[model samples]
Target: MGVQKEKLVQVPRIENGIGLMAGFDIRVIQEFADESLRATSQDDIVEKFRKESRQFGFDYFVALSLCDLADPPEDVVWVDQSPKGWDQIYIKNDFQNVDPYFAAAVKQRLPFVWSDCLDRVQRSKGVAQPTHDMLDEAASFGYGDGISIPMLIPGTHRGCVSLTGERPDLSQGPRHTIHLMAIYLFEACLRINKSALREWKAKEFIALTDREKHTLQLLGSGLNASDISEVLKVSEPTVRYYIKNAKQKLGANNVTHAVAKAMLYGHIEI
Candidate 1:
């Protein structure tokens, strides 16, 4: 008998209830102890996601323009606020002090739902009423409500994702949905960012000489010069010579640095 045709499974339409005025942007930032050790091409990664977000109905998506690895200031205007043309406002008026969303996101390391901004007086203490006025101004631009999700990589503090929109009635359900999407988007971005970093490091290391490359491979394998000499059938002095030359070519202060650079460049596994 012919296989029975399977019935079409019904799929429920999951509505986020987020209108055109609501949208999100994810920002990933990582800092290596050595500035040279930094990983991730943030611009390329952001561009990649900006394209993807369009398929998901995002009205607009942007990558935060990061200048340093330091955690962004709590009230940095463009860093926290949404709505077109805020970049000019942030730059011209210096709205950092009055932006509540940015302050809450950095301080709490939690998402700042738009509804949370309703407690105006309590949230804007000490700051000038102008700051509150600035927020009210932003609300006029379809950003009255939103959420900011802090994306913390294990060793980093500056990574975060911000979701914003004009939906005044964004309840727990839509909030959770946006939060979940932001988490997934940020996770993917992290992977791509790291991969790009590794590639760049590998390219930089690949420019080493043949002798340097050999020395790095042996060192990465945990072999001493004497052991390397025996393995490569060269004299101990010759092995030491090669190691020294490799270190110089790699601009390494020591054998350890050479090995680390080699591993970073995909020249050696160890």
Candidate 2:
């Protein structure tokens, strides 16, 4: 997904004020940011982000460049890693038109949850019933809970990073960590060569066997090991073996990350 062509007001520059930011570990955040900046490829950035973010229980991540609302940039960056079916549902329903988080990202410079922004929007001026209904539908697709962090970078359009899960660590500490991690990760993604990204990912595809690729595709489609075993006509342990091999080959920390990498890079499709 990328920026919409519609023209809007530009986001104002704001400084990150001082605070204890007690909820997150500064050391971990620093390490993650450093690692992200050093990443040579988009895949490497996503891998590092997934490894750190999953610790807080998030299942998906999306970063969008809300390029200078005054004028859509020539090149807009959008990165989405989510569960199966959610993307199709989002696009089919056109949720972006009514999404409050997008507005909040442009106007505010802080991290906020979906409900927080919805409530604020409702209080200022009531939104249509469709907004509520759209969110309800999103929850059914595993975006039951989520947080959005505004990414304010100079000389570029405003950006936002959103993470979703059934129940994620949204406490102050984890929020701080996630906020910093997302900012650096998005910046790193912006610096990569967008056109060459596919070629880089394609190079990795040669390492995955057909069975491993199939296993990841099924995993991305929301099947458990047992279900995949039945469908593949193999034992549960065999399914796990395939997953483990795929993870190692992909340099992923777990099955979910492996599946995300495979799906994001076009190694497999659900």
Which lDDT tens digits does candidate 1 get at residues 229-265?
A: 8888889898888878777766779989988867766
- Candidate 2 Cα errors over 4 Å, as ranges: 1-23, 67-74, 194-270
TM-scores of the candidates in the order shown: 0.48, 0.60
The CA lDDT at 54 in model 2 is 88
Worst 10 residues of 1 by lDDT: 27-36
* Candidate 2 lDDT tens digits, 1-270: 357766686885665755456557778788887887788788888878887888888889888787433344545567778778776776777766777887687788889987777777889998888788877887887775778998887866678899988888888777878888998988888777444555575555548888889989999989999999999999999999999998998789988889887876678877
Ten contiguous residues with the weakest lDDT in model 2: 67-76
Model 1 spans > 4 angstroms off: 1-58, 61-85, 118-127, 136-141, 201-270
